[model samples]
Every structure is written in C-alpha cells, then in structure tokens.
Target: MSEGISVVRVTSADLPPLHGQRFDQAIAEGRHGEMRWLAEKADRRQSPKAIWPDAKSVLVCGLNYGPDSDPRATLGMGNTATISVYARNRDYHDVFKGALKRTGQWLASRYGAGVKVFVDTAPVLEKPLAQQAGLGWQGKHTNLVSRSFGSWLFLGEIFTTLDLPPDPPEFDHCGSCRRCLDACPTGAIDAPYRLDARRCISYLTIEHGGPIRRDLRPLMGNRIYGCDDCLAACPWNRFAKAGQELKLQARDDLRAPKLRELAGLDDPGFRALFSGSPIKRIGRDRFVRNVLIAIGNSGERGFLDVVATLLDDTAPVVRGAAVWALRRLAEPAQAAAERARRLPGEADATVRAEWTEAMD
Candidate 1:
C-alpha cells in the first residue's frame, strides 16, 4: 500500500518468549503498580496461541500520531498541565479502531480467512509483534521506533487463520544514544529498555490509584497525565511529522491547560471536558489528584485558592493530593493553621500520611 500505513506479518511463534518472561518478572517485582489487569489476564497476554489456537499469522499495522511541535517544550510550563502528545488528541483506541476494521475486512475478503483485530485493550504484546513484523525496532525507550515514523506510531494487529509472508524484522538502531534513558524525569527508564512502571509519571498519574511516592512528586514536575521525556529525546523522531488524521490531531483545549483552571473542575465538569479523550478513563478523582500534583509542583502563589477548594474533596485521594498542594503553596504560619484545622478530621491513614509528609 502506498498510504502511510503499512502492514507486516509474523507468526504467533515468532512473538518473542522474553516478552512474556519480562511481564512475569515485572509482576513479580511489583513494578506494574495498581494496573492489576496486566497480571490478571497474563496467561492470555503471554502468547498469541493462548488467545486463539487456530491463528497462524498476525498482521501488525501502525499509524503515525506524531506531534507537530516538540512535546517536551511544555515541561517547563509549571503553572500548566502537560498532557502527553497522544492523549492531547482523541483516544487512539477509538480513532485507530476504524482504520483497523476496514483494513481487516479488506484482507479477509481477499485472502478468504477469518480475522480478529486488536489495539491497546487486547492482551497482545503489540510492540514486540510490531518489531517482529518489521514495523520498527523497540528502541532503548522501550517504544517502537520506525525509520519512517520514529516513536510516534500507534500499533494494532490482526490475527488470522491464513498464513502470510513475514517481513524481515527490524534490528536495534540505538547504538550509543542514551538520550531517552537520561531524559526520564523520574528515572523510570532505569536502564536500556527496562522501565520500572512504579517510577513512571504515566503510571503514577493514570494507573496507580494512590498518593504518588513523596520522593518522586517533585521530579514529576507538571506532567498531569503521561510523561514523554524519554520518547521526545529519541533522535529517531526527527523524521516524525504531524499526524494527518484529523480526529487524532491535538485539540486546542488540551494542549497546555493551566493547572489552576484544571484544579477547579467538578465531577461533571471534568467528565464533560474530557468526554472523548482517554484522560476521562481515570475519572474525576484521579484526574484532579494529578492536577493537584501539578499544582504542588507549580510553586505558583496564584493556585492557592484553587487548591483550597479541593481540600475537602469527596475522594480521599483527591483530598490528600490537595493537602500536598496547599502545603507547597502556603507560608509557614498559614500551613500550620491549615494543618491544625484538617489533621484531626482526616479519616484515611493514607491522607493523614500526606499531612505528616507535608511537615517533612
């Protein structure tokens, strides 16, 4: 196909064994955090055969969703939230699913075989399969980096009973570059291709449904959603162009929203604001919790009023996050008064820890 989209084929057996082994190891080491779904369906996640016995070949496809401007440019905007490049647009699962289904239908009709498609929600090791398919090699950042699309491609796959010719696999192009490794804000990418999700800003903001590790909060900066430091640092992305898909383009409202404004969103307001975006999946509580983290990191006196309103949020996690933000923005005398007023009424041990952690 002449279109930017390309499809490559690989067998289930071609899917590397180490991918599953790494999953087990990550789970065993407790690196996955509260995303228990990764461990719960791990048997199926381990291999393609575990999902469908008759599937002989997997057709991996990818679409580029690269940003027009560098995403890392927003990291210094401490008073505002830094949503990830991908989440700044409509959800990829929704935007890419349509293209995948159409492509799958065309393939099935031509090849006369049954097919099933999957994007992120599936248990498939998509990056490994994409690498197996010659879509790209998984760079040191542990993301697929294409010669053409760099690290900005969103992958999907079609499992089929019909066998197809497999393409030559892509090999490591990251020879000496440690830009991705060194750029991580939280040291999440501890070593080449090894990500400790527990220390990742994306996991802390989106998946881990608890107060973030106090030690890592300041390092998180203003990344209220996913962090892109590692991805943005990859030199291969010089080839990336803005995604042509209109639905996948960045929305003006999501680009660089101010922390104070986002901190004030009520339940319905949050839902309505992120209605079509993937950020909505975390719900208002966690979303506000992240905004509060950014507010705490902002070090801006103007956010005091916004953070104060959330001090009594219904969700304990939100309240706890607000406590941290208030402490960061308040002067010594004001913080003491607020701490004295709130400590006795705090019911959750974790929230209480936030108050005590504040004193430290």
Candidate 2:
C-alpha cells in the first residue's frame, strides 16, 4: 500500500435511491458536452450492484495529490502553460489502481471474496461512493471535498463480496460558501452542485476533441490541459497535506512549461514528454489545439511567429487554432497578409471559417 493514500472507508454496495440522478439530469440536458460515454453507461454507473450483482461492499480510497505550492500561481504567467495539479506528474489512474489492486488482493485472500477494482476506467460514480463512505461530500464545484485531504484527493474503489460495515456519509460543509463558484474562470459551476461541462475549461481542454468554442477560449487563460481554479479556491485546503508518493509528485518540467516550447511539440515529442502522464491521452493534435488556444490568450505578440508556423499544420484543428492565435497576436496588416497568403490554399472548411471569424 502506498503511504500516499490518505483515507480508506467502506460502504455497502447498496446506494441511495437518488444516487446518480444528477448524472442523469446532466446527460438529459446535454450538459456533459462531447463525453457521450457518460450517457452510454448511465445504467451501470447508478450503483455498484448494477455493474456487479455479487458486490457486497465498496472500499473508497483517497490519495492526496496536493500541490507543494498554490497551483494557481501560473495562471497569470501567460507565456507558460498551467497544467492541472493532478496531471503535473504521473497519471493517478495507474498509481491509485496499483494500490487498490494490492488492497483488493489482501481482502480476497483474507475473506476468500470476489473482488474487482476501479479507477475512473469503469462506469463507477466515484464521488458519490466516496461521499457515502465518509471520505467527503460533493462540494459546490461538484468534486469530492475531504476534510483531511481537502480538494486534492485522487479517488478509487475496490468492490468485493466481503460484506463490511458501512461508514456514515459526510454531510456538506459548504454552507454559504461560494468561493468555488466565483473562482471558476468560466462560469461552469452555474449553481451550487451543478456543473455545466460545456463551459468547463477542463472539459474543453481535455475531453472535447474538436476546436474549442471561440467565446470560451479567452476565459481559459493558459490552462492547456485542465483547469484547477475551483478546486484550489476551496478554503478547506488549509488542512490538506502535500502528496507523499514520489511518482505522484509534480515534475519540474511540467510545472510552468513555456507555451512556445509546448506549441513546438510534434507527435513524437508530445508522446515522449507526456509518457505515462495523462496529457498524452489527448494526442498531439488536441494537445496542440489547446496550446494554440493558450497562445491566443497569452496576449504576447512574441508568439505570433510560433503561431504562424502551425497555420500549415496537417491537422485541421491545429490549423484552425493557429489561425485564431495568429489573429489574436498579429497586427491587422500582418494578419491580413497571412490570411491572404494562407487562405487561398486552405482546404478545410473549419480552418477557413476560423480565418473568417478571426477577420470578423
């Protein structure tokens, strides 16, 4: 077991009747954005028994991933990209799952029970289960907030046939606290406990495959991978402890990576740099698409040349984002010259539309 795991509590496999109602509501309203998987697995995500009928208990585990310093410090550093604190090192899915597997193995040996583990891979509604296990309550930002670990926990679950005593669920402590709502760079947290993933920077940067919405690009600032503004804003973090797992600690290179350096990454470089990291899952085209948006929001004319280089990029999304960034950083004359120079040869309708939108 990794010493990084801060808390572990058990809950009965049976969940509340209204366990995943909000998820259904979010899906029905199309608030989950491009993440169709959420809706597809709606039934299985409702309860542990839905996924596995034999499961009698759930072990909810929290791994502290608190940043050594405030992760929001890089937000104003326009020339640098702000990766979410959780993604700055190795992917937590791997780290957390390893610990869960070891724990599950022990449970299986001791009780001769059937066991299965999950770490964001399954259709498990982890936050709700974690809350049910007394780890924390779902805060206004719609993330599990731990009293001991604060908002920095990486959660996983082990489903076993071993019937265990359930812990009392934690109640909401965010009474009259709207700091998380106000901290959102985009108004993704429309209401307390309500998150519209469409406007969420994390969803926009990491999940959405195509070009980002033009209106939300400016609000994203330099968050190229995921946004942590809401999570960092919670006052409960004062009690949080920095993660002790060496593999999960932040890598110095990713802390405040220069936008220009990141924008220059080709597929091989992107894969190599983000090897074993969560950022690589998005692929180079989407990753660079995010980098271009960050470049556009940087307000640094020095990035104009870098943006220009990506105009002829093979990926339509990359080309489109480059056009948007070019318009944002280049002067009217320079933008016109590049538009004239590149627009004639541009084949993708989306890239042409980006040019037109930038011109407009």
Highest TM-score: give the candidate number.
2
Tens digit of per-residue lDDT, candidate 2, span 113-139:
899999898999899998989999999
lDDT of 1 by residue, 117-178 (tens): 88886788888888878888888888899888888888888888887777778888999999
RMSD of each: 1.7, 1.0
What range of 10 consecutive residues in model 1 has the weakest lDDT sum?
2-11
Model 2 clash pairs are none
TM-scores, each model vs. reference? 0.95, 0.98
